[model samples]
Target: MENRINNITYDDMKVFFINKVKELKSWPYNGKNVVIAPLPEHVTVNPDKPSMFCFTEINDDYMEFRRSAFWLVSGTVVMAFMISMMSIAYLAIAVCFFYDGSFESTLFLCFFGSFFGLYVLPMAARIAFFIPHDLPVRLNRKTQKVYIASLILHGNIFRLRPELIFQEMDWKYIEGWVLHRSVGKGTPYYGLHLVENKSGDINRLQQACLYRTGAPWSTSEMEYQINNIMSTWSYCQHFMNYLPVPDETEKDKNFVFLSNNWLFKWPEAMDKASRSSG
Candidate 1:
C-alpha cells in the first residue's frame, strides 16, 4: 500500500542497473529486427550520479526527468552572479581608490584584478538573457498527469517572461517526437521530446527531453541514434500502456517515462498524483 525508498544500497542499485543495461542490450523489439523494438534506458547508469539520461527515479508509477548539463546551468548562474559582483566591484574599486583610499578596498581591487588576470567576461550584464533555473518535467502514470516546469512560452529573450510551474496535462493526449538541435558541433545530438498542442500563441507545451545517445551504438551512429529515440518512446509507450502489478512493487517497475531530470525537485509536485490509480 505504501512504497518508500529506504536502505537502498549501492550494490543493490548497481545490480539493478546492470540488469537494466542487459535488458537494453537484448531489448525485445517487436518489429522485423532488434533495432526497432523500443527498449527502456536504464536508470542511474553512473556510480556517482545519474548522468547520461538525467533520470533519478524510474518507478512503475512515475518517472522524473532532468536537464542535460545540470552543472552548466548551475555553474553559469553562479559564474554570472560572481561576474555581476565583480563588475560592480569594478565601479566600487574605482570609487574607493579615488574617494576613500581604504586599505580593504585597495586590497579588494588587487585580489580580484589579479585573480581574473584583469578581465572578467560580461556574463552578468546579459544574465537577463539566460534561463534562471534548470527545467524539469515529470510523467505520472497513475494520475496520468504530466507536470512540467519551465515550459517555454516564448523563445525570444527580448520579451522573456515567467517560467510557468504546475502545468499539468492528461497523459493520453501527450505526443513524443525524436528531435535534433545543432550547435555547430559538426554532428547534432538527437533526443526524445514529449509534447502536447496548446491553443494559444504558443503551439506546444510540455516539450521535454528524456533520452540521449547511449552505448551499444549501431554500425552507423545515426541509425542507432534514431533507434535510441524510437526505443525510448517505445519504452514510455510500454510503461504507460501496460500497467504492471509489480512482482516486487517498487522493484518490478518498467518503462522509463517520457520526461526529464531525475531531480530533488519533481517529487513534491508529482508525489500525490503518482500515488493514485486514476
Candidate 2:
C-alpha cells in the first residue's frame, strides 16, 4: 500500500477529486446545489455561460465613505458659500484700493488674490468632482482573461461603455492567488495576493476589488465561510493543482493564511518554523 501511494502524483489527486465532484452532481442537496447570485446590486453573472462575469456599480463601502447625501450636498453648499464670500471680499478690497488711490496696496492685494485663487479653486473643484463611482472587474474564463475597468456614469446615469483601467491579463499572471486574512476594527479584510509565474513577483490586488464588507458573521466565521465559497470557483480549483501538498520547501512560497492573528499556528506550523529558522 505504501509503495502504491508513493506512485500517486498531484495531478492524479486533482483528477480524483474532480471526478468525485462530477459523481456527486446528481445527489440531492436540499434539492440541488444552491447557486449564489452576484453579491453587490451592480454585479451580474451570466447563468447560461459561466465564463462571463459583470460588475456595474461602485461598492457600498466606498459610497458610504463618500458620506451621506445630506452631508455631501450640504458640504458642497457650504463650500460654495465660502467661495461667494471670498469673491465679494476680493471685489471689496479692489474697490477700497482704487478709491484710496493706493496703487502699491492694490498690487499687494492682487498677488494675495492670485495665491488664494490658485489653491482654493482647485480644492473646491476636487470636492465638486469627487463622486462615488463604480469600477468593474470582468473575468472571461473561456479566454482566461480578466479586465479591470470603470463604467462612467453621466449625471448619475449608468453607461454601457467601459473605461479600461488596466489591460486584460491572462490567468497565468493572476493564478497564484493567496488570501492574506487580517482583522481590523473586529472586521475581516481578505487581501488578494497574486504571483506572476515567470517573475514570481507578488501583486496585492485592492481589497475592495475582492471582499464585500459588513457581513453579519464575526471575523473567524467569515474567514471560514469565504474559504468554502472560494473553493467552489473553477479558477481556484485549477490553481490548487499547482499547490504544495502537506509539505514543500523553497525560499519563498504562496499559501493561504486564514487566521486573523498572525501568531495563530496551523498543524504543520512547527515544522515550517523549524525549517525556516534552521
Candidate 3:
C-alpha cells in the first residue's frame, strides 16, 4: 500500500501540518503524558533556536538533498573532473599493461577503484542528513506546558533507531518572540524566533514557527498578526504583564536579544529609500 504522507506537495504540507498539530494536541504519550514525537526539524521549527534545539534526523526532502549535492559537486567540480580524467587515463594505461601481461595492471585498477568510493561517501552522507519535515512540538492547554521531544538517530545501518530525548518547561518561561528580517530578490523576508528565560539566562529559542495561522508578514495592526511571529511576540509581551526587562549581560557580543533591531533591518530598494527620504 502507498504511504499517506509521502511525496507531499505545498497544499499537502499545509494539510499535513494542520493535522499534525491537532494530533500533537490530542495524542497522549504512553498514556502518562502528552508529548510530541520526533519530527524532522527543517520541515518545521524556527531556526535561531538553540542550534541543537531539535535532534537532527534524515528527512525526505530529496530535492533539498539534491540541491545540497549539487552545491557540493559544484564546489568540487574541478577536482571531480580532474579525478575522472585521471581515472580514464589510468584505466587506459591499465588496459595496455594487462594486454602486455604486466602485474601493474592490478595496481592501476585499485587506484581507479578509489574514485568510486570517494564519490559514494558524499552521496551517502547527504542521504543520511536528509530528514522528514515535521515539527515535534506538543502543547497541553490544560497544563499550559510545552514539550519538545527530539529523536537522535543512532546505531548502525542494520539496526538504526531513534533515541528519544526531550525537554519540558512552563509557558510562563517564554519571554517573547522576535522578528528576524532579511531581503531577497527585492522582497523582504521575515523569520519569527522565540526567546525564553527558563534557563535563568534570557536567550532566544528557535524560530517561532507560526505556520498554523499563516507564514509571518509585516502588518501595522498588531491584532491581525495573531498566530504569527510578530503577533506572538506581542502576545508574549502581554503574557509577561509588561515589557520584558533586558538582561544586562545581553549587551555582550555573545548574547542574542530577541529584539535586535539591527538583525531585523533590511536594505530598501533605491526608489523606496529615495521616496521615503523625500
Candidate 4:
C-alpha cells in the first residue's frame, strides 16, 4: 500500500509539471498559429522505406529521442561569427584612427563593423550562456507524459529565445506531424500549432518546433521525411497506447544515432522527471 501511494504521489507531481509548462510564455510560437490535422491512424508503411530511427534511450520507464544536432552546431557557428564580426569591426576602427587614417574612412569602418555585429547581438544573446547541443524528449509510458527540451530557431538564424525550455505534458494534449514544403511549397505558412492551458477554453496542445520548413524543393539526394515520419509516429504511438511496439532491433542497429554517450546526459531536472516513475 505504501509503495502504491508513493506511485500515486509521483504521478500527481508529473501532472503538476505538465500543467506548469503551459505557463511558459517565452516559447516562440510564431508562424505556427494555424492548426493542421493529426496524421491518419491507418497510414500504410513501406517495408523498404527508411525509418526515422531517432531513439536515444529506451527502457521500461520511458523512451527518449533527441532532435538532430545539426542546427545546434549551426547556432554555435553563428554565435562565433557574430563575435568575430564585432571584434574585427572595432579593431579595424581603432587601427585606422591610431594610424591617422582619413576620418571618413575610420567612420565608415566603425559603422560597418558595429552595425553588422549589433544586428547579430539579439540572435547571439538568445543562445547566450549555454549552447543547446540537442533537444531530448522523454516519453513516459506509464504516466503518459512527455518531457521535452525545445530549442527556438528559424531558417539560418538561431534564436535560442526560450533558451531550451524543458516542458512536461500529458500525451493526450500533445499533437505532432512531420511536414514537408518548399518556397514553391511554403515555409512558415505550412506548419501548424495550437496551445491553450485550461478549461478547453484555451489551446492545451504542447507547442514545440513551430517553424519546420519541411522537405525543400532543392532536389535533396536523401529520402523525403514524410516517408519516414509515419513509421516513427507509429512506433511512438504503440509505446503510448500499450500496443505491441513494432520490433526494429535489426533496423535500429543499422541506422540510428545513439545518444547514450556520457557527454549527452539529459539535464538533471528532466532526467529526474523522465525517470520519476521508472
For the record, the alpha-carbon RMSD of candidate 1 to the native fold, in angstroms, is 15.8
The top-ranked prediction according to lDDT is 4
By TM-score, the candidates rank as: 4, 1, 2, 3
Query: What do the candidate models score in CA lDDT, each in turn?
Result: 0.43, 0.31, 0.31, 0.47
Which pairs of residues clash in candidate 1, taking residues 3 or more apart in a chain or in different chains?
Answer: 29-37, 56-262, 65-260, 65-261, 66-260, 66-261
RMSD of each candidate relative to the true structure? 15.8, 21.6, 20.1, 10.0
Per-residue alpha-carbon lDDT of candidate 4 for residues 1-278, written as tens digits (9 for 90 to 100): 33222123323333432342333322212222223334543333443332445444666778776553322223353554466556556666666565457787677766765665565554554344345444566779988877766543444443334344566777765555433223222222232222313233222334554222232444341234343455566666667666556444433432212222333456787687788774
Better of 2 and 3 by TM-score: 2
Q: For each predicted model, how many residue pairs clash, with residues at least 3 apart or on different chains?
A: 6, 0, 11, 6
Candidate 1 per-residue lDDT, tens place, 1-278, comes to: 43212333333323333333232221111111111111233321121221222334556666654443211123334545576676677666666565457787677767755544433434343432344344556667767777665432222222223243446777666655443434223334455545453432131333444554432234486565556565445545545555322222233222322222333254463556654556
Model 2 over residues 200-256: C-alpha lDDT tens digits? 221222211222222335657666545533432322323223321121122122111
lDDT, residue 240, candidate 3: 29
Q: Give me the displacement of residue 259 in model 1, in angstroms.
A: 17
lDDT of 2 at 221: 64
Q: In candidate 2, where is summed lDDT lowest over 10 consecutive residues?
A: 60-69
For model 3, the local distance difference test gives 0.31
Residue 165, candidate 2: C-alpha displacement in angstroms: 4.2
Clashes of 4: 6
